[model samples]
Target: MSLPLISRAPGSGRRTRRLPLGALFASPYALFLLVVFAVPLGYTVWMSFHRFYFTAPGAEVDAPWVGLSNYRDVFTDPVVQRSFFNIAVFLVINVPLTVLLSLVLASALNSKLPLRSFFRAAYYLPYITASVALVAVWSYLFGTDGLVNHALGGLAPDPSWLVNSSLAMPVVAVFVTWKNLGFFVMLYLAALQSVPGELYESAAVDGAGRVRTFLTVTVPGVRPATTLVTVYAIITGSNLFSEPYLLTGGGGPDHASASPVLVLYQKGIEQAHPDFAAALGVVLVLFVVALSLVARRFTEKKEG
Candidate 1:
């Protein structure tokens, strides 16, 4: 019998095989990831465990070992606790409101109605507008004597929306929801479109009313989109920074609206405590990971 072509010599097989030529094509991107993402992440982790700071404005390297002291301080710090509380309140309020309103707006837009396209574009316009410009417009409307107060018609006093500690975080959450609503609406609209028209027709043939059809057909059909929207809303709501920062500077009249990112900014850039900021950033990443895991569990459960 002829020797089997599949057989390999033991020593010959031990020799390393060359990487595919496709890896040559991927080299640049791999290098970019290593340089841009991996290196910085590694450096941040290294810095997080040490007392690191620039000796001068241009200095790049000066860190003394501090072990887990920064992390310990991060957990014990009152400002950090306040920041977490602020993010918690924002997430609790913003996520549900955003998801619900977006679903409604998407369903409305998906319907055959007059001026639907115009309304879609109009709603999406806020999402495309510059953040600073949006903030300025919101600030104008929320001014003590401005349109919102004027619209109230003396039903209530014109409270300072951005200045009041209790109201500031809620206002920020609302602004975030409004700004991002259109994006989520677009997501749901796409999901709604993907739902088969046959399903709706069948529901109608079965004597199902609009509400019944919606709950049984429409909602379940878009479950994936709902999960995506919920997870996205959670991440964005938890990481809210710019709205609060621009609306009410320096943590909003008693650290009322301070997000973890704002705390990182204050510690790293403002106070020259990069090590502590790195630790805070790591903690925030862990928080996001844990929340995302819980969300994933719920999503998978619903799917099951």
Candidate 2:
């Protein structure tokens, strides 16, 4: 009689494993990112170490490797230095303004207020509007003969909002804050909803006033959202390009309103210094990353 056939686990002897359905479904997005982001990022890093220049199709050019010379040049460049400073100022104003206003507006909207839906839509309208259109309206409003100047009359600065070197970046910062406020408000709104109603009841039970309750309950409750908003504001503020580009006319008035990205465009695309621009882009990325980390740390720090 033959020995009893031994039953084994399914696929126990197989040399290969079947791909997970989740991975299979994710492959398209993975491939897309590899092609679009990874490849280009790799090429940029490679170019940053060389003296790269554009050449016509089928043309060969000597791209000498320069190690960190590109980086050194980027640091020494005055335009880049000024751009960094400008971005710092922008962040200083934009980050706090955005966070505070968004949180306050969200709190008000979250309360029993009249026309709540209409106000939410009204606030969000600017965020969804085309930047080009917004810039045009802003230009008109802040121009030498614009409504803002018209309203200010004799109180307006001598050089107007967009032209003054000291005011240009600040104006850009404010404009960005106003434009993106609704999105951050939405984030806070979601965070606020997630907060336990019990906390509010307890706070009220303790005789906490509105402001006290908000500080004790609402603010701490949305810590995660605050961190998110802070980091996002920093990143977006650092990469500011279009607002300054269109609003300040390509970072005019001695490049006072210029951002690192705007400078990168000027160097990389406009000036045809792709290698140098690549280096600048790399540095900007590092800077933004550093700033984001610092912001996250500050926001997420435990109260001692």
Candidate 3:
């Protein structure tokens, strides 16, 4: 017997499984992270637990598992300690200077000033320029016999800027701030443009001057951007390598300006201690994460 056909509403009775558009769109980036970051990070962690070293193709290798010995050694190493200390000094100088300069420059650029576009481009030129070229120019300008010394004469330091232990890291900090300032200033400019015109008008109505308006309205309005800038500054400051590497000549002058990344390269590639280098890398990642979190929390609290 033929069964009577029953009329069913569309998409009724049977469940229609729809593709997740969000995940579908995000899969490419997910795959990229898996290949680029996650896999390498997992391998680094695995290496950190073993005394691993590179070997010839098809060669039998014995990578003994060393547990936390690498971490212990990293902590005890004096050079590593000095590298961290140097980084701390760099951050102390770099972060504030970068933030202050970026805000000031961004504010100025945002105003109705003559040649605003020219000044903006001029400031941003150093940021987009090659780091090697910039460092070469900086070295020429700051060398003992360079124009700066010639201009200063006897007032120049006895050992010069990059050569002096006390001056080297600070010099690197300044160089980094100057090099990266344009990028940060761009960020601040975006943030500044978003601030409402009414706030400035209100401040003016209340007899607030430019300086007071900046402190009271402009600064507060850019709190979110401040958080972003601070976190970025800390992360970049912690990963400091290029400036010290190039400007200081591979963290030279007795390693006075050696950063953790530079030290990691020296240990891993130069000294063939991949295990120790992995440990240092892990520690540096953790340190940067912690600092970023602390900075975010501090800024968020102030924002609240």
Give the per-residue Cα lDDT of candidate 3 at 40: 89
Candidate 1: tens digits of C-alpha lDDT, residues 1-304: 0111112336663566776876898999999999998898888889899998758777687588899999999999898899888877887777788768888889988878999889989889989998889988898787677688778876634357788788888888888889988887887887788788999999999999999998999889877666666666667755767777787776787888888888889889899999999998888777778867766665455444
Residue-pair clashes per candidate: 0, 0, 0
Sort the candidates on TM-score, descending order.
2, 3, 1
Q: Which of 1 and 2 is ahead in lDDT?
A: 2
- lDDT ranking from best to worst? 2, 3, 1
In the range 1-304, model 3's lDDT, one tens digit per residue, is 0111212236663565556886898999999999999998998898999999888899989999999999999999998998888867887888788778889989888878999889889989999998889889989888878898899988999899988888988888888889988887887887788789999999999999989999999899877666666666657765777788888888878888988889999899999999999999989878887876676565444434
Candidate 1, position 47, lDDT? 89
On lDDT, the candidate that comes out on top is 2
lDDT tens string, model 2, 1-304?
Answer: 0101222237654676576986889999999999998898888899999999988999999999999999999999999999878867887898789889999999888888879889999999999999899999999999999999889989989899999999999999999889989888887887788789999899889999999998989889887776666677667766888898999999978999988899999989999999999998887777777866665554444221
* TM per prediction: 0.82, 0.85, 0.84
Ranking 1 against 2 by TM-score, winner? 2
Candidate achieving higher TM-score, 2 or 3:
2
Q: How much lDDT does candidate 3 score?
A: 0.83
User: lDDT per prediction?
Assistant: 0.80, 0.84, 0.83
- Candidate 1 Cα outliers beyond 4 Å, as residue runs: 1-25, 57-62, 156-159, 196-202, 289-304
Worst 10 residues of 3 by lDDT: 1-10
